[model samples]
Target: MDYFDPAGFCKVGDEAGFRNLRAAELKHGRVAMMAALGASVQHYVQFPGFDEVPTGIGAVTTAPGSYGFAALFLVSGVLELALWTEDPKKEPGNFGDPLNLGQYDIDMRNKELNNGRFAMFSIVGIIAAELFTGKDGIDQIGLDTPTL
Candidate 1:
């Protein structure tokens, strides 16, 4: 636990609290990584009818109207409540590797945690850059804006 929380900012005192914190960190990191990927991907690829949707934060609002958001909420709720509910007996973030990549060693896990932390910061930076500059991530980096 010290390896992940050396500064003790999490204020985790016990093993259960540390496990919970680890789970939360893993979830946030996964989300951040996906968000970072989406931020970059949206600039290049958009759905069939969403070509006119402005990239970056604006795209979130154009998510197929209210139904899209509601459906997403429903699906996420199901996933959270049914599929990935926490089990005290299991190790934190030990959700099975469906693909069976077999990279669950300590070194790999540490690498993933580090990468996730970096990704969380990166997504925040990307969103901030987009908000300030009014450009998607790809455009902000001076990449040629490809026609949709």
Candidate 2:
């Protein structure tokens, strides 16, 4: 997985240079997969109660913001990962017509980027709503702390 360490890569200056290079690429991919797995696990761990969806709109706004945040992360991650491609020709069948190439067409790329922006904005709004109902200034509009 040594992308920068010159000495870490397989012997690539000899007759088997191509093989060594391929081997190095495979190693790098393995390292990447392991890193992504760790990150994904961490992301899931942050949301302890994902299965419990609130019954209504008020319940949704008050029942731990982590629920919505986690859902957004999971959904967007799936969409982005599905669109990932280092080689356009080898993209999966579900990605759409291969004729409209460029690894990912502008429309697909925009969708991925916009999903991320939407998630960020949604999280910010969630936090702002939480803050508004916190013990400081502001009205008691949020259900996070109902007087009853």
Candidate 3:
């Protein structure tokens, strides 16, 4: 139920986190750390319950908007991992099961499992984006309906 404090998370930059990485790198390091922590923490703590609802000022003032996207990707990553693990039909050669190429038929479960790896790619992309975008830049990405 606790939210991440951007200021507190970013304190690493002002302290002893990345001394050699340039100013921008240090800032991005803090942002990446905050984004990852915020996403994982918020996903398990508030996902499915508060994701669709608005943050009543207290939450918004505490965690930045990037946390929201991070939460999204975090949930997505979890779901993907779940999908990957839940299916027993998934195998190394079944990667094309989703293609439905004649005998290949089209296994939705296998497809879902395959997508788990793709989802990981997305998670990495989310982290990289957060590093470049900072705390509030996720809002400007156009999904700006504002949930929290």
User: TM-scores of the models, in the given order?
Assistant: 0.86, 0.24, 0.30
For candidate 1, write residues 1-148 as lDDT tens digits: 3446777856646787788888889888888888899888878887787666777887667756344557867998899789998888877887877899998877877777888999999999998998899888999998857856
Candidates in order have lDDT scores of: 0.80, 0.42, 0.43
Over 4 Å off in model 1, which ranges? 1-3, 6-13, 63-70
For residues 40-134, write the lDDT of model 3, one tens digit per residue. 44433455544543332234434454576578679867854665332224432233446555564346434443454355454466556655665
| Candidate 3 pairs with clashing backbones | none
Point to the candidate with the largest lDDT: 1
- Candidate 2, residues 122-143: lDDT per residue as tens digits? 4444445545654211122332
Off by over 4 Å in 2: 1-104, 134-148
Q: Please name the candidate that would achieve the greatest TM-score relative to the true structure.
A: 1
Candidate 1 is scored at a TM of 0.86
Quickly count the clashes in candidate 1.
0
User: By how many angstroms RMSD does model 3 differ from the true structure?
Assistant: 16.2
